[model samples]
Target: MAGKHLLVLIVCLILLNLSATFASKQNTTTLNEATACIDGASITLTFGFYINSCPEAEPIIFSWIEKAVSDDPRMAASLLRLHFHDCFVNASSFQLGCDASVLLDDTPNFVGEKTAAPNANSLRGFEVIDAIKADLEYVCPQTVSCADILAIAARDSVVLSGGPGWEVEMGRRDSLSASKTAANNNIPGPNSDVATLLSKFQNVGLSLQELVALSGAHTMGKARCSSFSARINSSSSIISNSPDVNLEYLQSLQQLCSQSDANTTLADLDHITPTTFDNQYYVNLVSGEGLLGSDQALLTGNEETRRIIECYAGDVEAFYEDFKMAMLKMGRLQQVNGGDGEVRRNCRAVNQLGS
Candidate 1:
């Protein structure tokens, strides 16, 4: 009983600190340096597999994450997104699971996913991963895989953002090639309807609940206006016809995006508690304030989605648990048919094209 009470006290203290740090913009120290993950017993290919081969691997990567996130709090979300974009790609020619193919650079012989419509100028944190891999190679050369680094970094990001964590499966290999074609087709756009979102998730072995839970990630980052301008623009059919938006909020969004660079303008996904990884995203959806049409679609998708949203909005712990589980499942995905797999000394290229 005392142990449980102690844990509760610790959590409360962490939340209090996070709120203070965020409430002050002058404090460039955005994301917290410490991790809040309370659990790590979920999945493991061989528990502590790196303990023997490269004891310094996880620590090295984690140290870099701490420094990077401390300097730029938004980095935590970018690392999490790096893993997400890495895992969702597919190729008609070859299989490319969570192999870190998304990190590859384009060559004369073939293309990569960076330039895909969903990814072009959208992804970040590549340099950070490069630094982590460089340090890993220095301590234990060629022992850690880029794919595994992404998974671990993602878990750490969530933990630092006041979310739950799970043991990431290690030993997953990296991809030898990336697929621009697959990335274009596989990743869903922000304007996707609930049906399209459901189809996309289902194609990757996820369900509707996972869909609702994973969308909760929106609780952190900001979405570019280009991604959802149609939903709030008066000239767009979605705004003119849809009944799922808050009029006052929509007006603010319109004014914000009215700039000539409106397409690149940014807006928070969750207006309430946008920095913390809480259940506020679900709460926003229930109130029709979800930034992206795809996100708001969950509320009106059907009874099941609506029920899941309401449940998460009412219970934060449940949202964390479900989000963690869904992320684990997403980390396991390899959408491409038969892509290459090997640990490259440099994450940007496969073994053959060593930098």
Candidate 2:
């Protein structure tokens, strides 16, 4: 018992030390002098080390962006996460599981005729960025782009969610076009079999193994019944009948998401690992209990993908390392940074400067 107690204490201390190290690494000293290269690239720059004369300006703005939706901490966190959630699997062309049509038609929609929205699998990061950008614009005018805000917000989100802190290279310019066609052609869908999914990831310069690991992000967020309805029911509208799906769970889900419109109850994929940012997502895959058909496909259908899943499921450290690399890769997708494009003052508004 004494030995066990000592072991637990040592592990806790190590974790605490790691946490402190992560915090120190993340809190960059505000820079006041000239442009310093942030991530080794000449274009990368930051303002962390310098003392702010208008210190209240940034804090008030940051705080406003964080709490513009409400005084709630969870809402603040959601603002930080909304950008990623919105763009993860863009379905602009298909509206697969999104309510984008509501915006297109006379019906009232949240973000206009935008191809993404209220999607179960949407990067929850979008909702937050909207609030943050609105607040920041009131303070700093045109100094910050939604893209830079997004990059910062995602890094902070990862740390707050208990993952390792990543170095954010800034100066990414905003995109003028939010192409529904680009999203449809690029974003991988829930029903995609492993090969199709791999091809999609490869298009973005990611490896097959990294593709399997990246799906672990689904472990944290909510999924609309529409997003997973095909897995649960025998409807040709969305998911096809696959041997890999769990029959019993599908029957239960049909009760919740039977509506043909695809808008209904949402399910949390990693119910056990809700906000912890851990490897239980991979572990769940091994149990033949992954929520989406696309999820289970990682462990089934393909031997190489399945083997990678097995490795990640068994080794937590390996999963963490792979996840970090995969995230870095995902963050790089379709970025219109620096010379690529101009920073949009408003994220929702396309770059009129380009036209």
Q: By TM-score, who's the top model here?
A: 1
Clashes of each: 10, 23
TM-scores for candidates 1 onward, in order: 0.84, 0.67
> What 10-residue stretch in candidate 1 is worst by lDDT?
30-39
Model 2: per-residue Cα lDDT at residue 129? 60
Question: Global lDDT for candidate 1?
Answer: 0.76
Off by over 4 Å in 2: 1-113, 116-127, 234-248, 258-262, 337-340, 351-355
Candidate 2: residue 116 Cα off by (Å) = 5.4
Task: Give the clashing pairs for model 1.
Answer: 91-336, 94-337, 94-338, 94-339, 95-336, 95-337, 95-338, 95-339, 96-336, 97-334
Lowest-sum lDDT 10-residue window in model 2: 97-106
Model 2 TM-score (2 dp)? 0.67
For residues 304-338, write the lDDT of model 2, one tens digit per residue.
88887777778765666566545555555444434
Encode model 1's per-residue lDDT on 222-328: one tens digit a residue. 88888987778788765566676677888888888886586578888878776677899988888879888888878876788898889888988777767765777
